[model samples]
Structures are given as structure tokens and as C-alpha cells.
Target: MWHIWTLDDWEKNIDLERSGHRCGLRLRFDKEVDSEVRRACKEFAVFLRREYFFPIRVVIYVKARERIIAMDGDKCCGIFWCMPDDYTIEPYIRLAAGDYEKLCKKWGKDSALTNILLCMAHELTHYFQWINSIKLTPIGKERQATNYADYVLEDYAETREHP
Candidate 1:
């Protein structure tokens, strides 16, 4: 099992000086998960930086799979890949057939920003797990991924309420 506190530690270690207004988050989930998922994540990351003063660049890659596999014998689902230094948003946008102008029109600037922040936080949490040498069976990793997604959604809602 991976430690959840890894995310908390990353949050604390953020270097505000290097953080920027834009994030290049990538998701590696099923392509069928909804085209908006990537958009939401990028927007939320932007929101976190703008509102909380923790600027960051989040790049996401959403990979499509025929079926989710379990890391172990457990019932977890979904997998994510992330890197701290590789914050490039262009590739992901191309994969998802998305553009900035369309997102801004659909979600509004503020909402889109917040969505990116949320996604970045979630993906970064996974990166933390990887960096900490946390290992999860296939099933366990899948479960963690599912839970992480839910947590991100909840966090986005909370942020919106208070922001």
C-alpha cells in the first residue's frame, strides 16, 4: 500500500517561485472516461495557484484501455502516470482533441482554472506515491486511483465553495 501523506508533504514542499499560472497536466485513464475530465483537471490546477498562491504547472495524459487491470488481487481500478519536471500540455490537448478557447467558453475562465488545479493535485498525489517508493499490487493501485479521483472531485467542490 502507498502512503497517503505523500501528497501532504508535496503540498508543503512546493516552491512558489518556480510555480507558474499555467499547468500542463496529463491523464492516463480510459479515453471513454469523458473528454471533460482532462479539462476539469487543468482548470482546477490553475485555480489553486491563482487563489491559494501556490502556482504550478500540471501536465496530464489520459490513456485509453480496453479494460482496467488490478495491480493485485484487490478490486482497485484505473492507472495514472505523472512526472514533476515534464509539464507539457500540448500533447495532452492533442490527444483529447481539446483547445483552450473551447474550454474557456464552456467552463468559464474561473471554473476551468479550478478544474485544472484539482486534476493536478490528484495526479501529483500519485507522483508522490511513486517517489516515496510506495508499492501497491495491481488491484490496490487501481483502488487508490479510484479513491483519488473521488477525493479530487470533492476537493474541487470545497474549493469552489470557499473561493
Candidate 2:
């Protein structure tokens, strides 16, 4: 059920930044996903490029699971993870597809997409923390990511609400 995207899978219209989007994104989906999921993920990729200033290829594993939030390794592997920690270089993001559906049911389609966007932002925060964890304790890293996710989500909502 996992799919990989290289140059072969690159869509012509996909917006990869020139100067900063350095990471070669390798993706693995537990099942088929939509264009919005891909798009939301690319936003995270862009964030990584602009923020970290390093070229680290990352694999994202999207899965359909019940009641589980997203995780960025060092945590429970969701439903369909096969490999161990060795495969975690640049580390893979495990996103909860069921959570997306829950957002849709509770809010709406737009809200669901935004929820995924925030989740992506959240996981990206984890990646940065994981890489530069020397300056941060375990609790501090989690706190930073959580605060970052909340701040980004609020900013995003405000932008959409006004614009």
C-alpha cells in the first residue's frame, strides 16, 4: 500500500521551491491518498527547507487508523510500519488518516485540510527538534513542537479568516 515518489512521480505543476526546497521527498502511503494530502505535505517540505537550511530526504507514511494522532518516530508506529529505527534517517512521519476524516465530520472539508496542514507543521517541528536536540531536553522538544503547531494553526486560521 506504500507508494514512493521520485522524479518519476513528480507532477509538472507541483511547486517545489528552487533555492531552499533541498530535500528529496520520498513518501510511503499505507493506502491511496488524495492530491490535497500531497499538497499539504509539500507545505511541510517547504517549511523544512526554509527553516533548517539542510538537504535531508524524508519519508512520510500516511495511514488509516482509528483515534491515533500523528507521530514523528520516537513514538508508537501506527498501523503499517515495517522497518525499524535504521530506516529513520531524516525520519518518517506517520500521519493519521482517520483523524482527517474525523475533522471532516466535525468541521468540514476545508477544516479537514487545515487540520492536516497543522499536523504536517507539527511533525515538521518534531523533525527540527530531533535534529538539533542537543539544545533541548525531551520535554522541551515536545513543548516546542506543540507550541509551534498551535501558533502556526492560529496564524493560518487568521489568514484564511481575513483573506
TM-score of 2: 0.56
Q: Per-residue lDDT of 1-163 in model 2, one digit per residue for the tens?
A: 3111111222232234643334554556656556565666555555545434323455667665543443453333232222332223345577765566566679887777766666655665665444332256768756766677777666555544521
Q: Give one clash count per candidate, in the order shown.
A: 43, 0
Candidate 2 error regions (>4 Å): 1-23, 43-54, 67-88, 151-163
User: Which residue window of length 10 is worst by lDDT in model 1?
Assistant: 88-97
lDDT of 1 by residue, 12-128 (tens): 444345754353333344445445655555555565445332123334444332223334533222234445344332212112223334556897765554444443454455554
